[model samples]
Target chain A: MYPNDGFRELDRQECLRLLAKVPVGRIVHTRQALPAVLPVNFSLEEDGAVVLRTAAASELVRAVDGVVVAFEADEVDAATRSGWSVVVTGPAGVVTDPGEHERLVRTGPRSWVPWPQEVFVRIEPELVTGRALVGGRSLYGVRPPKWIPARR
Target chain B: MYPNDGFRELDRQECLRLLAKVPVGRIVHTRQALPAVLPVNFSLEEDGAVVLRTAAASELVRAVDGVVVAFEADEVDAATRSGWSVVVTGPAGVVTDPGEHERLVRTGPRSWVPWPQEVFVRIEPELVTGRALVGGRSLYGVRPPKWIPARR
Candidate 1:
């Protein structure tokens, strides 16, 4: 991590690592020129693609096919006032190959929502970026405010 | 909540009520024609506007002033496979009036990032929509698969 301002920039590998760790993220796509953000259960694959399952009737399944979209995932600790966030931008391609779809279903993150999530989509990342706020480290190495509790 | 498929739609008042309960959300905006999704700590006002603080040098402060943006917030239960999400769309107007800015600072959500967050942006919602997946309810009213865990 390279510190920039009070946050540090994470390398691509670190960003992908974190992306794989989290099961839920928000996918941002444009609908009729207006941006729409939807939460999704997604998984990162070995080739750096992000995969997600959705219902066939989902608006996302319809709108995001072959479209450039943004995926964002993060974890924040309110008690410690710190967290890491990653964003990936890419083209969202629907998984149409039956064999590939079957493999993805067995490997990718599953939706927590109880719906028929039969459609699979993959995002081939064009850009990956991330930032982290190290719990006890300020930009200039000053002591944190007493009000901020230390992490366990 | 009126059921649509396996999800239920929440009205405006219910949407705002849920928005006020969460302190963090992802704000979506367009940057150079591409959608940018950012994690932000935000709060809701009595009149249904959303407010958040960011550093003056932040890209969000530069890109979102007087622009329409999408804000999404949600909570999910991993154990019960249930969740609810709310999305708000509106113009993100920078709070420039001194009294108004101060009042927002006194009540709006504060950033946990260790930087000087001097810019305040408010999103007065023009459109609000939300959906919730109630626990124990399937779309077809059939018993959920045994793979699905029961609510604790």
Candidate 2:
């Protein structure tokens, strides 16, 4: 459980690890009266960012800009009684730059299921938060883990 | 593969099956210049509807009223060279009635992970749509299956 004072901040590498283990995640963005969330396939980037794919004219692509979007990924190990979740909140937009898109194609966004026709989308995170559940019989309480930022 | 006209509309039972097989899906809503797509967990109700969970104070509760929110679930069977997708688009909103909430609890959502403290949200679908992929050798195209309206 997070302290009421604030959500514990996670370092970049820890966030990356959490992102990698979770197969599915929620993307939250503003719509009319409130925010909306959708699920997408994603991969962790070398810079500790997130990348996913969508159709070229996807509504998700249009929502990018000053909007605050959140991408959350989590994994739970029931037998071990442990789990972790990472949320990357930042600016999102379509990767229109030809050079950047090509580079990403070469080195970023690995997919569990192959779908090469999908267009790639990138998230530049402004805030990264995460929590880990540990202890039980192997039992313990859930709490936010210590975070260290990735070295730039 | 579907014909150029559009993917076939799916039946209610088929939509339920597609929902059960996929672990992730997107909830799409329109905002400003673009539409917002967020990932969410959903399940097929006994009445052949879809149910989800979200924070009571979530924007989703507000945005879903009378608006067209698209809930999509899909999966690909690589070995069989087949895949199928179901999309439920309709009016969505928060469910606060104790009776309704309890009924949903008894039925359970299709979540791989457990979320004991989460709140339940339900979507009354107005339209159900779907498609399927078949064939082993060729990259078959997509086509619409069928469309069904919600029960009055």
Q: Report the number of the highest-TM-score candidate.
A: 1
Query: Residue-wise lDDT of candidate 2 within B1-152, one digit each (tens)?
Result: 11231234467778777677654455666544344454455677666466776544445555555565767666644345355666676677666688888877777563333333445656666666666545343443342111111111
Which candidate's DockQ is highest? 1
Measured with C-alpha atoms, the lDDT of residue B90 in candidate 2 is 67
Model 1 complex DockQ against the native? 0.29
The residue-by-residue lDDT of candidate 1 on B40-151, one tens digit each, is 7778888888888766666666678888899998887646656788989889987889999888778877655445447678898888888765667555366432212122
- Model 2 — TM-score against the truth? 0.55
For model 2 chain A, where is the 10-residue window of minimal lDDT? A143-152
lDDT of 2 by residue, A37-110 (tens): 54455767767567776545445665644466777665544344345657777777667798888887776554
Cα lDDT tens digits, model 1, A102-140, are: 887788767554454467789988888887765664543
Candidate 1 error regions (>4 Å): A1-5, A111-117, A137-140, A143-152, B1-5, B111-117, B138-140, B143-152
Model 1 pairs whose backbones collide: none
